[model samples]
Target: MSNKIAILLATYNGEYHLREQLQSILYQTHSDWHLFIRDDGSTDGTLDIIKDYASRIANITIVDNAGEYTGSAAGNFFKLLHFSDYEGFDYISLSDQDDVWAPNKLQAALAYLSLDRAGGYSSNLISYDNAMMRTSYIDKSQAQKNFDYFFQGGSAGCTYVFTREACLLIQRKTVNITTYKGRSHDWLIYAICRANDIPWVLDRQAYIFYRQHANNVWGAKSAFSGLVSKFKILRSGWYRDNVIWVAENSGADVKGVEVFERVKRNKLVDKFYLLTIVSQLRRSKRECNLLVLILLFLF
Candidate 1:
């Protein structure tokens, strides 16, 4: 028997580009795949499109949310993770309703996903504007070490595929309420994988056309804009709060917990204290974004 793949898709008010994305999935080269989608109280025509597709495809399953809204995409995705038919698949994937997947997306992800260990596979994505015109490719390779996963914003959930062990690790460790509320679903997964020493395979190939629009909950921004945003977040202290939340809820190792405890102390009263904290956490010595390095000082 062939291995089964479960593609988890979460949507809310995504009627505009939902059909195009669904069509792209139909063109995938991988044939042994099932789509499990949950509509989080979409008041638009999103359900109609989903119904149309489900009526035609036997492998597609419309997961019931009991008409309750999940508030955010991250929450909806987490709900999907909790409600998924765990024993029915070999591997799991995340998908956004607006992105158009390449024909080889699943094939490439499966190639890199190793079943022997708890690990994840993610790839770069070719970003597209609202008009569906290509803009630039988003590189998710900056995460060179476990520490990098916390310091930098990396891949979106839509680009990830995880083995059963990896998925189980996340499912078993996360405190569904606080974990999903404080961090994005993908970030939670990355942190949990790192905590347990699971390898993350980040491919450089762009496997999907990631759509960016005004309604995007977290859209791509320029480097300068990202820096400004980070600075603002640090100033407000939400970054520090979120980091601590993730570290505690994702079951990070002793050292991981120790470093974050230093952040929780909020002892950055001087340059000396800042240097001490950065030196303690920068164990990997891996190259990271300069802005991220600066933000580390803030915590």
Candidate 2:
């Protein structure tokens, strides 16, 4: 028997490129998949396109968001995760409304993920500009290092596929989270995997064309270009706060839950002591390592 897969997609004003993306999914070589979509209050013809596809596609299902826009893409995806029916599914994958997927994307992910006891899988992505021209490939190789998971550098939620068990863990644990508090859904998921010591695979294959456009909540940023943004996060101490946020929201079984609590409750003077000793605080890429270290020391 073939494995059942659920593809969770969140859309907002995506009418222009949504059809191409839907067509790519329709053409997937792996056929035993169902699409579960939630529209975050699209004002344009995005819903019309989705309705058209739903009219013809038996596996397509849509969830109503009560006509309110989820302020962020992360929030929208989290909403889908919160509301989607998870039964009878062996795997769950995320999708972006504008990116065209490779026909074997799901197959390749399952191949690597099924070989081991991995709880989830993420892959590299081939990037494209607005004109459909190839831009570059996002690398997930160096990101395989354990510490790199905390940095949120190369991870994209659209490339993530979770085993049923992992999805269950998330659904059960995060059910009580009333708000993400600007936490990125992808980064939070990665952090949860790390905190639980859940084995995950980072595939080197680029199986999705990650689209870059002006409306993108977070655009592709090269190593050098991302430094300033990293500085601001460190300077504002949002990174540290987010670490605690993820730990708290990931439920009782997450490893280092106590440490996050301690950090969250610690005085300013104590933050310096705890951050320097805990290597997890230095979760930046090699290029920004020194900067992160310095900021942690001074902040």
Candidate 3:
């Protein structure tokens, strides 16, 4: 039997590019998929567009709590995971409202997952800027580190595909999360899978066109600008807090978790201690060095 995929899409005021995104999904080479969308109280014609598609597409479904407001994108996706009949499908994938997927995206992801016998899969993406008529390849498929998920996500959530077992694991792990603490769902999912020893494949292949726009929740930025933004986030203490939150919620057993807890106290000794083991914290060497600087001076 063919693998059946359930695509979870969370939308809010996405009428502008919703049609393109939906059409891209329809054009997928792997056609045995069902799209389950949950609109987070869209004020625009997003709902109208979704309804029109649902009326024509036999497998497209608007999930329950269609009009309810889920304050953030992560919250909306959490609701989708909680309420959707995800177990009915063989695999689960996530979709952003504006990205255009490659025709063989789903097929390629499943092929990788099955061949590797992995629980989850994510890949690099091409970030496209329409106004600038420019595109940049965003490489998230760097070498994996021991505790990297505690600091960063595996890849963009829009490129995520997981086996049914992986989806169930995520749902169970996140079921009791009362507060997101401003953490992205993708990051949390990656952390959970890694924490629990589930094998994840990070394919060094671009399968999605990640749209960049002013309204994007977290659009791709230039390398220098991205580092600066991360610095600001680190200075705000939100990054540390999220690390601790993820560690506790995901039951991470790494020694770095304890080190991070001490680092959170903001003591000189604790901060210095983290620098010694910084290599295990991030996937890229540049980020590892950057984290060292942040700890030495900023923290």
Clash count of each predicted structure: 0, 0, 0
Positional deviation of residue 234's Cα in model 2 after best superposition, in angstroms: 4.1
Better of 1 and 2 by lDDT: 2
Residue 214, candidate 3: how far off, in angstroms?
Answer: 0.4
111-220 per-residue lDDT for model 3 (tens digits) = 99999989889999999988978999988888898888878898999999987887788888888777553778888888888888899999999999999988888879
Deviation in Å, model 2, residue 192 alpha carbon: 1.9
lDDT digits (tens) for residues 198-251 of candidate 2: 887878789999998767766575557567766676788787666566666664
Supply candidate 2's per-residue lDDT for 120.
85
User: In candidate 3, which residue ranges exceed 4 Å CA deviation?
Assistant: 223-228, 253-257
- The order of the candidates by TM-score, greatest first, is 3, 1, 2
Candidate no. 1 TM-score = 0.87
TM-score of 2: 0.85
Ranking by lDDT: 3, 2, 1
List the candidates' TM-scores in order: 0.87, 0.85, 0.94
What is the alpha-carbon lDDT for the whole of candidate 2?
0.76
Root-mean-square deviation (CA) per prediction:
3.2, 3.2, 1.9
What digit string (tens of lDDT, one per residue) describes model 1 on residues 25-118? 8888988899999999998999999999999999899999987676888889988888854786788889999999999899877876644243
Model 3 RMSD to the real structure? 1.9
